[model samples]
Target: MPSILLCPQDTAVFTREYLNGWYSLSAYYASKLTSDLPMLLICPTLFTTIIYIMTSQPDVFARFAMCWGVSLILAIVGHFMGLAFGSTFDLQMAILLVPGLSIPFMIFSGFFIRIHELSAIFRPLCDISFYRYTMEALMQAIYGYDRPDLECHVEFCYFKSPSKLLKELDMLGDLYGHDSGITN
Candidate 1:
């Protein structure tokens, strides 16, 4: 979502391509936005629909809506990135910068790396990641205490309940109690 959809558009809009063009830059961006609308809608709809159905999760519509909401947010972030940065090269640099920024986010996403084990310095950054909220909400929806129990080997017996495992990783939150009208 960083610059994949908007980098070329950014280059076209910010450079001489738009300088000699007839349309205003804002109009150009508007057109660019319109051009991307279909894929944005279609891809997320299909993606979320498929994953929700195939995975057979409870609260199907909620998960679909949450995933779509995240897709839209990330798409908007990418679109604004094109508007904010000056060049495709800068966008590329921003792409590289993303992994550095995102690695901490990913680590704190409560999936791969354990949030409790992380040093305190990264706590603030973890909270800042857009992925954090979505992951939290998704996990809350799919793995709350009331949901089905998980099975594991003797050494992994503690994972019998998803909420227990989440608690062990410091991924549990008050989000479950607050009906967010989407994932939670």
Candidate 2:
């Protein structure tokens, strides 16, 4: 009635069926928008203004939705998160985020340079470095350096290369048992 160009009689049937199929597909996708995806991402993309107002208010609804809502959908229907995301966290290192000596341990743990490289006066400081623990853990994770091989290299490398100090410590570790400590 508004602007009919009067297609051929057979074409009208095909056109009507095409229109119905298109409408059905749009409705199917529209229904999935709520149950299928992250509401924050999907809601705004599907309806921009509605997303803006709901997000602007900053309510508990947003918080709960973040932790629970989408994950629930994933659990029930999609990826079966029960099997997918179990405990991959390292509780030990997480605990060591703080250590006993605290201050100097962080300073000495060989992050910037190895601790064996530090000055002789600061050598005693190595006894308390958490950096040493972190380096030892890293090295042990790769391959454990035996106790003195671990110790003197850590000391000399604070200023010099730990590899060279490692050689010296190899000699020392062979000569001395676990108690030699770091001498000048």
Candidate 3:
């Protein structure tokens, strides 16, 4: 966030976009605070681990499968990114920035509504969200997936897939019964 905003004008490149443009970008960086990634991962990992460990009649592997599964991983990774260098944690800025930043993303991540169906403030979040991108990635991986959904999904966006995921899922359905749910 600040990287885009706080670039020293003399040190940074400009394409005659104009002085006002540079000023606005710099102001935005000055007003931003970064979200700490390692801290965020630490908190959730502890919660999931505790929940997985504490529940009696526990199946450790099953708990991981259920709780820390692909969807959660996708969401967590998205969080690390969206908040990475997001804004300064100042209360004054945070007061507006926190809700301004997150509530919309929460609403847009398809947990609340489909992309085509959003309204008001939420509509913008959908347009800009990395979560939306990541969600598409997850949907692609599991859907019509090959034997490699695990590797590709955990590695997340690193690999490029030229094949359509739905096509893979469709082909998989032919080779294996769709009802088994074992392809993933």
Q: Per-residue lDDT for 105-159 in model 2, tens only?
A: 6676565555567887886776565345434433332222332222333433451
Task: Write down the TM-score of every candidate.
Answer: 0.68, 0.24, 0.34
Task: Estimate the Cα RMSD of every predicted model relative to the unseen true structure.
Answer: 4.4, 25.6, 13.8
lDDT of 3 at 127: 61
Residue-level lDDT tens digits of model 1 in 1-184: 5344466566755666666776677886688679878876787678767777787666656655665666566556545654454243465666666556657677676567656667898778666766666666666656764667765557757688887866875656656333333443
TM-score between model 1 and native:
0.68
Q: What overall lDDT, based on C-alpha atoms, would model 2 receive against the true structure?
A: 0.38
Candidate 2, TM-score vs. the true structure? 0.24
C-alpha local distance difference test of each model: 0.63, 0.38, 0.45
Say which candidate scores most in TM-score.
Answer: 1
Order of all candidates by TM-score, from best down to worst?
1, 3, 2
Instruction: Give the per-residue Cα lDDT of candidate 2 at 129.
Output: 56
Order the numbered candidates by lDDT, best leading: 1, 3, 2
Check candidate 3 and list the clashing pairs. 32-88, 33-87, 33-88, 34-87, 144-168, 144-169
* Cand. 1 Cα-lDDT: 0.63
- Tell me the spans in candidate 3 whose CA falls farther than 4 Å from its real position: 1-41, 50-90, 116-124, 130-184
Per-residue alpha-carbon lDDT of candidate 3 for residues 1-184, written as tens digits (9 for 90 to 100): 3322232332234324435475565554343323444544566667667765675323435425434444455445544343442333433453456456666666677645776566675677776664554445434433323333323435455333424544432222332222223344
